[model samples]
Target: MTTFASSLKKEIARVARKELKDELGALRKASASYRTEIAALKRQVRELQVALRQTSRRADKALHTVAPDAPAESPKRGRRAVFSAERFKAQRERLGLTQKDMAAYLGTSTLSVWKWETGQVTPRARFLPAILGLRTTGKREVLQQLARGAGGATD
Candidate 1:
């Protein structure tokens, strides 16, 4: 009777271990599948990020022109330069031009120039090209441009 009881206990233990192993094997397979899916998703995300960066660079290049005359090709859709009221005022002061002079240079009214300097209004998109055009001009070049606009002959 004692021998039969020991044999029964050992058989029960063996069966329990076999069942646990089967359960563990199934879990391991599912875990591997989940890991593979996660790795694939990570790879896809990396690829998408690279593609987005390339697209952004292309758009940025399109917005910025390389040549001086490139803005003339598309004045309405030319490179957009950043503008601020303080910067505008400072640039005008640095060029030693009065508000009226700046207005004349920008082909706008004196009131508009005042409004721009005072931050009463933002400059229109149509004026961005002209504003960017003058960013590189010196006081002498501005004077020359103003003179030319006043019907003075250019040398």
Candidate 2:
């Protein structure tokens, strides 16, 4: 009778261990899948952070550096008187530009520039801003503008 009872107890213990092994196997598989998904998410986050840093550097460069060929900004005022025939001629001569080059830079005809310099005709109100913009331009910038064909004329 004692031998029968011992064999029955051993059988029950073996069955419980088999049931627990099945449950633990499923749990382990789920844990591994979750770990792989988390690794993918972390990799994506790192790539986005690197891209954001590159974009920030580009924005900073655009904001801080001014181009040498760009014109200076003029202050806004109530109908500022910024153009005169003599001043126009002087600005052209100061940049060592001929009347033809001046006309191209200002996007006008050479005859019109000649007339403006001789004070025979006043330039139209439309040309005032471009004429005024030349006042602060340097000689090197003027030459560069001419070389690039200021009025869209190709060399």
Candidate 3:
């Protein structure tokens, strides 16, 4: 009787282990499938990011011009330079010009120049190029440009 009881216990244990292994086999295959799907999603995201970068470069290229009079300029940046009230004031000082002078050169009112310098308002997008254009020029060139707008010869 004792030997029969020991054999029955071993048989029950063996059956439970086989049942557990069979159940886990299906779950193991599912986990591997999920991992492969995640890897594919990650690869697609990387490809999309590369495409976005290339599109942005093409747009920037479009903004830059190649005029015969202008010559080939630095790579065209799609966005305009940031407006700094201090920078505007500094540019005027660098060229020994006043608010009225800056306004005349930019084809705006003196009050507008004062407001820009005080940070009460920003320059218009149309005026940004003219203001920034002053950065690359010297005192003589700036005077010439301003005088030309005034319809007179520069002093």
The prediction achieving the highest lDDT against the true structure is 2
Cα lDDT of model 1 by residue, 64-141, tens digit: 433433333334466336556666787889889998888888878889888877766767777766665666679998
What's the lDDT for all of these models?
0.74, 0.76, 0.74
Evaluate residue 109 in candidate 3 and report its C-alpha lDDT on the 0 to 100 scale.
Answer: 84
Question: How many Å off is the CA of 105 in candidate 2?
Answer: 0.9
Model 3, 47-152: lDDT tens digits are 9999999999766544432222443232255644566676678788999988888778777889999988876677777787676777687999888877777611
Where is model 1 more than 4 Å wrong at Cα?
1-80, 150-155
Candidate 2: residue 15 lDDT (0-100): 94
What C-alpha lDDT does candidate 1 achieve relative to the native structure?
Answer: 0.74
Worst 10 residues of 1 by lDDT: 65-74
Checking candidate 3 for backbone clashes, the offending pairs are: none
Tell me the deviation in Å of residue 129 in model 1: 1.3
- Error at 126, model 1, angstroms: 0.9
Instruction: Candidate 1: give its CA RMSD in angstroms.
Output: 10.3
What's model 2's lDDT at 98? 96
